[model samples]
Target: MQIHAHYNGAKPDPYLINHHLEDNRLSPESALKIIATSEPGGEAVGLPEFVFLNPQADPAPDKPLQYMIKELFVKETFRSAGTGRALMNWVIAHAQAAGCARMDWHVKPTNEAGIRFCRSFGADAVAGRVSFRLMLR
Candidate 1:
């Protein structure tokens, strides 16, 4: 997975996934949760498809808390099946309902499809913004 590959060449932390599942992060005030289900039984299909977001702390008091989309992805086969839109819609709706001033996410410039998808939702790319990270290891 891209996340696995990005973590300093180390595997993803299982504990983190467990913590996400166990926490209140999916509550209405936090982030919306979307789960793919099986056809017949309607059980969770699981894996390779999910969106994770959280309330972002905005420094500006005039702005309500913002929601940050931390991770979003759909299974390759389900890419165009409206799954991504559904997940995004859920997040947007909940964010608005939670009194968030805005929603934000980071997308790679080379991810043309992702850029288009975000644009389709009326998202604008902010100018002069860059992300930096320091590896503690």
Candidate 2:
């Protein structure tokens, strides 16, 4: 079994990722387009987002640093194969190597799997929720 991390834009599995995330308009292109169109910085989006996946390679960093996990999803078929754990492991190693004192994750409370998996990574909820009302049309 082999594991790799890569940008969706450059991978052969873009098709797979697109297919898996398509139902809810979760394609990487659309996501990037959204980012590109953001007003210089950006506003908050409540939707679950994945910034990267199993990257096979790493960027050349002169110092210790962990790559940020922009978005995450558990592929239905790979749930039992430790894919999620592998991803977290990559994060841990990256952070440790990057000189970060600790790593963090933000998962919705309703995401039981995400919650459980994060706990498995020794992630404790240091803070609770912050809520507000939106006057959407």
Candidate 3:
């Protein structure tokens, strides 16, 4: 139920959230995109979802901006309910409106379902990049 708790606003660890919020508030090129889904009668159907976006400008000003999807998630129970597709479509619309050339996000190689889902949107894995992370305490 950690996903449920997280989307319900129980910020067990506030450091990252605070940092991202601050960054969003301070930068025009950066933002936090949060989408909350609920029932028609105003009931919570599942946890809210969110994605972090950063619009990077191309070297050539004539080109459109590039939007990076820093993170994306939907509750496991809510998968295949059209929520993920709807959310991704919304992101795509927003990116287009913002004049973004493309919207990009990475997926773990082990997540075959994720890869398939992304591919459904015409997203292909970039051939030359490796994802790396370094956690600092």
lDDT of every predicted structure (CA atoms): 0.65, 0.48, 0.66
What TM-score would every model get versus the actual structure?
Answer: 0.64, 0.46, 0.67
Residue-by-residue lDDT tens digits, candidate 2, 17-121: 557557544554553211211123552211223233223344334433333455554444556566556656665665666565444446667879778888877
Better of 1 and 2 by TM-score: 1
Model 1 ranges with Cα > 4 A deviation = 1-63
* Best lDDT among the predictions, by candidate number: 3
Q: For residues 35-136, could you state the per-residue lDDT of candidate 3 as single tens digits?
A: 556658764444323343444433435545776775566666677998788778877887777766666777889889989999999999988889899999
For lDDT, candidate 1 versus 3, the one ahead is 3
Q: How badly does each model clash, as a count of residue pairs?
A: 0, 13, 0
Give lDDT tens digits, candidate 1, residues 19-111: 775675555564454444343666332222234333344454555566767667665566777777877887788777776778778888888
Error of 1 at 129 (Å): 0.2
Tell me, what's the RMSD of every candidate? 5.5, 14.2, 5.2
Error of 2 at 19 (Å): 16
Deviation in Å, model 2, residue 92 alpha carbon: 0.5
Worst lDDT 10-window in candidate 3? 45-54
Q: Which regions in candidate 2 have their CA more than 4 angstroms from the true location? A: 1-68, 128-137
